[model samples]
Target: MTMGFNESQSAFAAALLDPGLPLPQGITTARGVTDPLRFAVYRNNVYVGLTTALGQRFPVTKRLVGSEFFAGMARTYAADHKPATPLIIHYGDDFPDFIAAFPPAASLAYLPDVARIEVAWTRAYHAADRLPLDVAKIAAVPPERIAEMSLVPHPSAGLVRSDFPAGTIWSAHQGEAVAPVTEWRAEAVLVVRPAMHVEIRFLPPGDAAFAACLLEGTTLGTAAQKAFAAAPDFDFGSALIGLVGLGAFSAFEAFEGKLP
Candidate 1:
């Protein structure tokens, strides 16, 4: 019934994350040092390594705030949120919300959204790969039945909505900015990795709604109608073509039946 730890795994893990606490009961150094200070080396190494890993995962967040500030903030965050999984690449998914609440970063209200965009990018990059949908097959479907078809979104497709123009902020970091924008605007972002690269695009209002529906398994006709209801000027043709260009879908099949 026992597993990896000589003592309790919980006790060992707690001491690793909490440097102030005494070393776990069964641990010992070669010199037989009894003081908690004996465990300081392991504590420092674990904390430093995890903080560095988080900084790598949230490069934009680090850039958004200065490195020193980010490091300090990262320490505060890592204290409470221990790594739940062995994979560090996907760690810090909640750092955005942590930033939103961190008092020093509160003035920069958009920091959380920017972090979310970064998370989306990392997730898309690691998502499973699949060949792009065949546009010709979709084109051959009868016009009337096309509405009843449902799209199978690629594994890497994602959507992010923010009250701030996070896409523009992210772009500014990529050296694509000519000048800083003064006015604030709401934006919706599409995150996808069609091939080798992960892309972030500012999604049109209707497209986000329509794509949301498709991703949720709604019929294409119902999705488009709902999108049009949200934005009367929604353009189905352009959206479809653009998504196909991005290779956002893997297949298009009838919502409830096989194609003839």
Candidate 2:
């Protein structure tokens, strides 16, 4: 059957990741004959390239699972989740979700969150550059009006709240020798690239709740209230200053009336 150029291109692309699919019609070597062996080699190379890309994107995840196991799992993921765009960097946006649902990775409950952290790191690295909210401007606001203001998170600011020590695990993997994670507990991580470098910070006490509320456009007072509810010892002052120091906000909005 005759196929249009676009149709052939689509078929060829699909078959690259899916080895079960037959070679696209009209595909042949320079010798003018279809060679199944050559096509198999090409298919294998495509899977290898994509698996390598996933490995690079999720190095800690790869290290957590041995190279052999990761390669097998990555190949399976690439086969089902083909690239939506031509840009390789954008290929694995859904990988964290994939790892979460993948049966082999079910035993490692925290693996998904770790992948999410890696995903955030890559996104922050590529995010558009913007000037962070100036600390001085925040300090200048009248104390009475502070509660009604909403701080705008930077474009690269992302939160990863996990029930396990995902941030600690991720941080431990950054060094040459993996450090043991003695404390096993929930962790709320802030991933942001305010300037040249992407920074990862573990939020303390009620800071996560406060940051989450602020990111959702809630007023500072409301957010502080929520944080206090989450942590009895929540200090609104320290939390505000710390987040500003990390450059988590790009701008802020002030309301004339009292904010709930």
Candidate 3:
């Protein structure tokens, strides 16, 4: 009897995973060589391709774990979770979860958050393009109505809050300016791509709250109130200026059907 396609495919998959297994019947060997040796090359290539793709996605995580350890983790992760899509860029969505449950990485509680930040960075890099708000337009808003104004956050804007100092840790590894510190602290981060570049910045509690409110479609006055509530010394003017500097604000629209 002829083998069904599903059975044949299952055998092929098993053979790829286990080099000891022989290729399915009716599969021809190349150059009259043994099927096992030919299949071994294919299996090795599969591992190498997947490992390379994962490393490219999580370079920071790979660097943190070291080459050998990263390769091992990638192998296990790939075995457990095959890529659902053919796009390599979107291959590692489950990596953070995998790392969180990985036994060897249990000692490093912050590794998962680091993976999340890396994923966010990649997503921001591929987000749709948009022009940042013009500072002059924001400045032209009347002082009286400034509080009633609402600003749109860019499409790529995202906030990440973590108990660990993931933002600081990620920043330290980015080859940017660093400060001497021996202790870890809780952190909140804002990620956005205003023009074409993805930028990540550590945010203070109040600023993070304010940005969250704005991203949630709250009015400027309401968000400022929340920010002040979070941090009594929160500076509205400074926050506004900082957003402008970061290109966080896409455009300004008034609360009452008016345009800034």
Candidate 4:
């Protein structure tokens, strides 16, 4: 049957990533013959390119599972999940969730969270550049008005809270030899590109809660209270200063007071 340009394009795209689908209608070589062997070669290259992109984006996840294993798994994913955007960098945004449900990776429960951190890191790297809020502005706020103020999270800021020690595992993979994750407790991580480089920080549960609240536009007082509730020993003053230093906030918003 004859197909329009859009229909032809859709068929070609669907068949490109899926080997089971036959070649689109009217597709022929220079000799005007439909060659399944030649088409298969082109299809293989597409899958290989996609698998390589996934490997680059999720290096730690690739390392956790050996190269061969990763290649096989990545190929499986590439077959089922085609890139929605032309930009390869954004191709694997949902890869973490895919890993979570992948039967081969079920034994490594932390693998999904580790992939999540990698995804967050990639996003932080590509986020729009924004000048971080100056630390002095936050400090100059009147103590009484602190409760009414909310800090604006930077465009590059991301939080990853994991039930496993995923942050520790990710950090350990940064070196040549993977360091042993001695502590297996739940971990929360802050991924932000506040300056020239992206910073990956492992945060305490309280600090993570506080950052999450602030990122959601919660008032400073409420965020602090939540932090305290999460961990009684939460240090409000130090955490506030630490986040500021990390450039987590790009600006501040006051409900009823003027800016400093």
Which candidate wins on TM-score?
4
Worst 10 residues of 3 by lDDT: 174-183
Candidate 3 error regions (>4 Å): 1-37, 140-151, 176-180, 216-226, 252-260
True-structure lDDT of candidate 3: 0.83
lDDT of 1 by residue, 92-197 (tens): 8888889989999999998999999888889899999888787777778889897888888889888878899887887788764445867689988889998889
Residue 192's lDDT within candidate 3 is 86
lDDT of 2 at 234: 95
Error at 222, model 4, angstroms: 2.6
**Error at 214, model 2, angstroms:** 2.1
lDDT of each: 0.83, 0.91, 0.83, 0.92
Please write out the lDDT profile of model 3 over residues 60-140, one tens digit for every residue. 788788999999999888876766788878888889999999999999998889888888888778877888888888778
Sorted by lDDT (best first), the order is 4, 2, 1, 3
> Over all chains combined, what TM-score does candidate 2 have?
0.91
TM-scores of the candidates in the order shown: 0.89, 0.91, 0.76, 0.94
- Candidate 3: clashing residue pairs, number: 0
Between candidates 2 and 3, name the one with more favorable TM-score.
2
Report clash pairs, candidate 3: none
Residue-wise C-alpha lDDT for candidate 2, range 176-202, written one tens digit per residue:
899999999999999999999999999
lDDT, candidate 1, equals 0.83
lDDT (Cα, 0-100) at 96 in candidate 4: 94
